[model samples]
Target: MGMLCGMAALSLVLGHADARGDAPPPAKKPRLVRAPAAAQPAPAASPEAGLLRGPATVPAHWSRNHCPDSIPEGAAYYIVVKGDTLWDIARRFLGNPYLWPQIWDKNRCITDAHWIYPGDALIIPEVNVVAPGPGGAGAGTEETPAGGGPTGARGPSTPGQILFPSIEETALQCASYVVDGREDESLRLVGSEQGATKVAFGDRDILYLNKGSNAGVKAGDVYTLHHETYAVKHPDSGKAIGLKIEVTGWVRVILVQENTATVMVEQACADIHLGDYLKPFERVQVPLVVEHSRPTRLTPPSGKVVGTVVDMQDDASIAGDRQIVTLNLGTANGIAPGSLFVLYKVMYPSVPTPRIVLGEAVAVAVRDRTTTVRILNSNDAIMNGDKAELQ
Candidate 1:
């Protein structure tokens, strides 16, 4: 009985110890299971991966914005780059720079040929490909004539080619000319609606004339507005021959009262001022002619008649290419419109020196003793008193 009681006491002590949370047996470690390869998440792609693909795989938005998929037949799309002009484009594609007007005609969006911006798409008209000159500058590719020196040398226009209008019609209409001091001053511009505030008038302005129904003025009658500038003297004789009459603008009578007439300004080349005289309006016909190459050599003078550049338009003393100048020779010297003249300078009359070829000009308006010429080309600045001879 003593042994049994001892064993019972020992067992109770062990139970009490276990209940008090003594150190327990260690737990088994968990095994990490590998996921299948197919179940793994895919790796992310690089940002530049799309660029590795060809242009065909490019995004639709980018390709559409950059270029057209296809252009029209017989025409090419030219994305205007910096430093591009209609003249340069025409010469590059159409073989002639003067054909720039054709391009302007085709692209009505280009209101002014003088202005073109980069990135603006232009339609290039395909024409005969002129053989490019040396350095591919698109110089005149037409073969030189028998006696003409080379392709780029100055000479007459090539035969069997079309002639283009060299001068604009408006330029011809506004050109100044000379007349004998015999113009009738009976009809004149007297006042305007804005005459009190404005000293000059332009197109679409209303004006009043001094003459009316009593002086034979009628509605729908067009008159040229002119004013006497100064007397043009002969360069050689220094004698006054004719008056330099400047065409300020044109006017058309709208209503005629007993002693006054109401008129509207049709075109204004210069400022239309009060006291401007009026004459019967004559339509000026500008000629269509080939622009001849400038003469480079010491070509013999035609001896038709020699003259001097007395004055330039707008009181300018120096003139360059495309500037208007007045010559002392005119109808009395057999000078006529469209006539070509070679401008030369005799540096030393005493020394036997060849006349230096300065430039060339074309007569646009001819009067009795004076002619107005448009300088076609000038190697140097042409000034008053420069010598000119018919070519």
Candidate 2:
């Protein structure tokens, strides 16, 4: 009886399996299909990529509508809007449109002076205003004597209410001058890493310097890159006084080896090239002073010292206002930087002719026997060999 019961149970289980044999195959498991990742957009090229001094990052407090209430010490903020220009902004805030470069110097994010976006933020530098009192506004004030005084004598001063801007930093940095002696050639721009496709280098270009740690060069050392253009001859004596050097650019040492150093072009006023000489960097600042009024009537020579305009930087036959010219008079003639000169023309030394006044210039850089002057104003074209009298 037990065997028969077991046989019956096994047959029932087999019958149930046979009934489900034809039943639908097991359901398929769904496969996951991921969507393609969204494509990332490329970064826009900066218009001022190689011109900027440092890496640019958008300011955290930047806004198009309003500037932040809190600002950096000694600095104010300005939010750019459409149709805004650096020139206009400078005139509106600094009271001088020519001071736009100062505004540009303060804001590193601005790449091009021509294009400032509406959302961009700018830093307005504080202008030093003189207060009314001695040693402040009218301390050094002097009147233009009916008869001109000696060269060392002060020229006429502008009113205390007027303010003049200093020389543009770029002009002062790239200024070419006549040197009494050859610049030290110990350091030179030997080569560059740009291979051979490029002959001219500009701002931020990597370059190799011939000088290194052995020559007192170290990381962070700054130098002025320049090249001698030609020898300057005295207009009257007809003798070689010095060589004229054209500043190509500036560089900073990044790595120093035994006999070589790696440098980067910091500020480029012109194209830099191999074989350019280097000198210890100098910081030049042309101070602000009361501008002298242009002399309208003929003024007698100061008789302190007389010189001639030897050459001009541009080599143009004629120079007008705000041009750079080389002068034969220098420190030896009691000519110092910021000294004023009255430009004139005397056709004949023997014959008495009217001292034709041309323009005025100020000594910017002075050596023992050579000086560089920037023509402040000119009613007529100033040329080489024009007479410059100390004022």
Candidate 3:
């Protein structure tokens, strides 16, 4: 017909140029109405707003919430007197009066270790011990009373402040302020040496008392140098001589160094042997710490001396001197009103300190407990219907 209408007008102009290149069909993806990853709302773990999401063992810088630095640069004190007792002063300076709460948590200035008051003055902190792996920097951190933790918003048990690889931030010598324990005669010996996990001198190690100045020990006394799993017998043919030993080690005087002192050794558990034996458990019993001062000028009672001295005097009341007297149990032992009694003469049966030079009174003096004393003048005319021991 005219070439079939000229191929139908070139097939209708190639179907209108293939519908203008056909690209408008992709505009239909709006079906993704995925407004349902379960309807949103689920992202609140630990931005710290009450933190506590999971796995944080104690890593908020080690968590103590920060409060440290209360006098740690090498501390040691011990004064109190008159029959002193906090389990006998933590069994003579922390050999274990059950540790007296580690000296009442290192003294925090003593809240109450039986009211400690006799002239006060008692701190013995210092436990800087850190000997773990790579550089070792651990000590002090153990607080937890900021208030309302558990995410309520009172946090800070120990969170930040590590600096001590060079060693100098040392606090914890029982927290200072004095009060908890260590005053039945003070001079210390605490310890360190990382507790000798295989201590050696021939192998090239030689550190028997890391820093307690070899018993002149002071600076918070707290030794270990451990390895006493028991069973070394021989106190009287008990048997069993050699099984596992480099011998004893258990110190407790935080900081004291006229030579070299600084100990912690809480408990080495195992491995420690380089001539071990850094002993002494605290018995220096009253060398100085008489800080109960309050008599700014009230000095009275030069002759009022209450009774209790049933005979025992060696000499020491030097403000004047007029010795001679005796009584049994007058004034019920309270005998205050100027209190001062020394009269003691048993001759023997008082000395027991020997755990490696006991707190060292020059290595060993308080031995037979030393005796002989005098001075007693208060007892309503002092009488003794029982044993008679007053002066």
Candidate 4:
């Protein structure tokens, strides 16, 4: 009964609405809702896009976003980005965006800071980033600094010139390090060769090395190839052990393979054959500090600790064409900054003398003057000119 009444009331309301519709009712439109605005995109940095207007043969740049506020007037920093823009990042690193171009110009690698994606590393430059003007990268026909060349600017001369102590020309400025591992090699014929043609060993074959290019094998790479030979006593009481061939000699790795490699056959006098095993003929990597192993007691006959000059950062020491090339020495060698000692040359002494009897090595960086030599938290190397001796 309730349902019937409800239906009847609905019909009445519908009928009433239809009767009133004759008064010309218009069409109804649905309301639309507006969406919230999004954040604005960062402004583009207008780094100079022209010729090579930078100092030296090489130049670098801040290849990351910058925070405008953090950047100081003349500080060195690599641009990084997490939630920042070039201007913001610049300000954060350099303290100003007007100095962005100076940083941009010095960092020639950063051609397009916009395209600088995350994870791409950059080499930040030191102070005195010359801009594009008379002292900067401005194109002009005027006098330039001595080391400035045409586009670069040279700083005024100073008195704290630090030059690297002269070393033997033999010890090269090699790209990497070299080691010593030798065991007085010797090769000799085994038995009589009266009629040894096509002997019992003819059944065994040998694998010869055919070295190829690109291995960078510039001589002195030893290859040890071996073959087993078993034999019994002919007409004796005791058994004698036969000697398998253990040949070794320096070779140039010519043909490099995916897994297997080929090397030149340097010594073939021992009647070499086909099936001989080959690999790097390694002796022994003597400890950084080894005891008596050399023919002479003075020498170590093994590996030695080595280091190189990774940086030279003394502005005052860079005058007079003399770069204060710091060495890989210091407290590790029992040196401290300002700790004075006579420089000596590292020489291998003769019979009566011991190896590395120091003679004359130029005094290099002091603790402070040395590159990457710190005397802070843990241990700092002594200043340049400190004595370098072998304990």
Best by TM-score: 2
Residue 306 lDDT (model 1): 66
lDDT of 3 by residue, 4-35 (tens): 11101111121132133321221111111111
| lDDT for each candidate structure | 0.60, 0.62, 0.26, 0.27
Candidate 2's residue-wise lDDT over 32-143, tens digit each?
1121122112112232321111123436543322333344443345655555666556555655444355566566455334445555656666543221112211111011
In the order shown, the candidates' Cα RMSDs to the true structure are 33.4, 26.9, 33.5, 32.1
Put down candidate 1 lDDT per residue, 108-196, tens digits, no spaces. Answer: 56533444555545565433211101111111111111221111112223334444443555666777877767688889989998869
Please give the distance, in angstroms, between residue 43's alpha carbon in candidate 3 and its true position after superposition. 41
TM-scores for all candidates: the values are: 0.58, 0.60, 0.16, 0.19
Q: Candidate 4, which segments miss by more than 4 Å at Cα? A: 1-170, 173-254, 262-331, 334-359, 362-391
**How does residue 183 of candidate 4 score in lDDT?**
28
Over 4 Å off, model 1: 1-159
Question: Candidate 4, 24: how far from true, in Å?
Answer: 97
| lDDT score of residue 5 within candidate 4 | 12
Q: Which 10 consecutive positions of candidate 1 have the poorest summed lDDT?
A: 3-12
